[model samples]
Structures are given as structure tokens and as C-alpha cells.
Target: MSEKRSFLLQKQNDAGKLNQSKLLKAEENARLLVTLQKKKKEVEQLRLQYKLLQAEQSAANKRIDALKQKLAEKARCKEAPRVHPINPPCLETDACLRQTAIAYLKARKQGNASALSRHFAPDCNYQYANNREVPNEMVMNNIRELWEKWPQRSYRLLKVAYRDNHVELIYIYKYADQRNHSIQGYAKEKWETNSAGQIIHWREELHPGTSPAESAGYRLVPLNIK
Candidate 1:
């Protein structure tokens, strides 16, 4: 009876050890599951962040493309051709007159009277319709006043004729005041050059009702003086 009791006690001890081992293994598996869940959450967060970054990068690229297109359009507009072009075969005697006239027009555009005066002779005569002739010195003041009165102006040549050191130009004159009052009129101008190719006589006439037909056979050509 004593031996049997001892053997039963040993069996109970073995069973307890086995149960403890099983419990420890289950606890270790639960810890591994917890660690796996945390790792999965971290991976999910990283995926979401990557998606946001990709979206932002795509938007940035689109904006860059749009800006590039806008700049290209501006460049194209800037590269558009100018209205005036340089042409050859300008008359021998009238070449200086053409250059002087173009320079005068350019000076008017820039409001530079000194530059305009370089094309005129010392004793130049400038006259308008039904008006007394003015000295060359008066030109500077007159042009200054004209530019002051008409702040915005444009002169488009319609026709030109050259003969005997004299040239005639028909042009469209556009003038605008500070009040935005604008008018466009046709005008005829005659210029006579001295031996030194300086303009000595300048005559101008304004024709609001009729256009001059004398230049019908000629196309307005640019001197390309500038």
C-alpha cells in the first residue's frame, strides 16, 4: 500500500508539469499574435502615407506643366513679327529723306526733339495748311506741346513718293488725349531735302474727308532707318 501511494504521487507531479508547459506555450503564441497585429498597423499607416505623397507629387507635376505652357504661350506672343520690315531699292537721292522721315517719326514716338532736329537744316521751314511757316527752333516746342496734348499716338504710313530730292508721304494719324478721346485721320506731308540731305522744307495738310489718290500705284515701304 505504501509503494502504490508513492507511485500515484509521482504520476500527479508529471501531469502538473505537462500542464504548465502547455500554458507557457499558449502565452507565447498570444504574445506573437499581439506583435503581429502591431506590425500590421504600422504597415497600413506607411501605405496610406505613400499614397498621399504620390497624390501630392502628381499635383505638383501638373502645376509645373501648366506653368510651362503659359510661359511658352507668352514667348510665342513676344516672338510675333513686327509691322514694319526693311526693304531695298530705296531711291538714291530720296534715301536720306526716307531715313530722315523715319527718324523723325521714331523721335516723335519717343518724344525726343533733339533727335528729330538732327535731320533738319539750320534754316528749315515747317508749315501747316493756312498757317505761317515756323522756324526750325519752333519745331521742338511744337512737338513737345503736341505730345503733351496727345499722350498716346501712332503714325502709319500709307504711301510715299520721291522726286527731285523731294518726297511726299500719306499717312494715317492716330491721336489720343488723357481723357481717352481718340481720332484717326489721314494726312499728306511733303519734305524737301537740301544738298546735304537735310530736310529744309516740311509741309503738311490734313484731309479728313478725302483720301489722296496720288499714291495709288505705290505700296508703303519701310525704310528700316532705325
Candidate 2:
């Protein structure tokens, strides 16, 4: 009976000690949980601070970009300068008919209808291939018609001579047809007596391709066509 009683008492004491140990362990777990909650709160605050810093950085970048754009515009304004054209510009005077022919050629080349009408006299004549004489109106009309037909036409001045009222010129007529062919040419022109030395009648000869004898001639005279 005594031994059994002692065993029973030892079991009861062991059970009480185990209960106390369990209470201490529970308190330790509670303190650790509180520490974890505080750490979580601190982490959330730091994340908020980081997000605010990122937003500030983004706004600062936008402001810097805007400032750079404004600076670029100001630089562009400083770099660019304005220039004005000279009024009543000085005109080039090379020779008598030379200047006139140059003006004529420039106007003719640009297909300036108004310029052509001013220079070309109504009573004009032209002589073409085989001593053929064509009217001045016909020659002028031919030029206008041909230019209208071929817009990309060009003429190269080969040679030119002028003395008092006598004028002569040579040119190679070309179109954009990509043909490596050039015609040797000569023109004899006489200014009209009534029209203040305007070209009235003209005659021309052309050495076709490489032909010295297989040549062509043209004559042109102008009259009032209206």
C-alpha cells in the first residue's frame, strides 16, 4: 500500500511540473508572435517610404525632360538666323546681244510663255534644213509646241559671236531620250530695222549626227498672225 501511494504521489507531482512548463512555453510563443507583428509593421512602413521615393524620382525625371525640351527649343532659336533678299538687284551685262540672248535662252529654257512673248517679234522668219524657209510664226509655234510635247528638253550653247547688229550662235539641242547624239549647228540672225534691233529673220544649218554633207537648213520669217 505504501509503495503504491508513493508512486501515485510522484505521478501527480510530475503532472503539475509538466503543466507549469507548458505555461512557460506558451508565454514565450506569445512574446515571439508580438515581435513578429512589430517587424511586419516596420516592413510595411519602409515599403511605403520606398514607394514614395520612386514616385518622387519619376516626377523629377519628367521635370528634367521638360527642362531639356525647353532648352533645345531655345538653342534652336539661337542657332537659326533670318536673311533678307536685296531689292533692285544688279543685273549682269556681258555683251549687247549676248545679254539679250542669255535672257532669251533663260526665259525659253524655263518655258516662260510671258517671257517668250516679250522677246519674239511677230514679223520673224526662219530657214531650216535643205534651204527650207519657214515663217517666223511657224518657228515660234514649233518651239512652243515641241516644248509642250517634251518638258524635259535642254539646250547647250556650243559657241556664240556678236558684233554691232550681226549675231551668230551654235547650240546642241537635246531631250531626255538618252541618245548620245549631238548635231553640229550654225545660226545667222539679223535684227529688224523697225523694232529697235529685234531679231526678225533667221537661217540655220545642222550637220546631222556625224554627217558633214548630209546636212539640213532652215529659214524662218515672222508676220502678224492675229
Among these predictions, the greatest TM-score belongs to 1
Highest lDDT model number: 1
Q: What TM-score fits each model?
A: 0.50, 0.39
Taking every candidate in turn, the Cα RMSD to the unseen true structure, in Å, is: 18.2, 20.0
lDDT of 2 by residue, 1-226 (tens): 9999999999999999999999999999999999999999999999999999999999999999999999999999889895432111112212344456566667667887667656655556554423344544565776787566666656555444443334455555555423533333333333332225556556555544532221233121111111
Global lDDT for candidate 1?
A: 0.74
The Cα local distance difference test for each model comes to 0.74, 0.57
Residue 30's lDDT within candidate 2 is 100
TM-score of 2: 0.39
By TM-score, how accurate is candidate 1?
0.50
lDDT of 2 at 151: 66
- Give the per-residue lDDT of model 1 (tens digit) for 1-226: 9999999999999999989999999999999999999999999999999999999999999999999999999998899875432222355434554665667677877778888787778766777412445667776667788899999988876666665556677777888999999988888887777766667788787888676753444434455533
Count of clashes, each model: 0, 20
Instruction: Note the residue pairs that clash in candidate 1.
Output: none
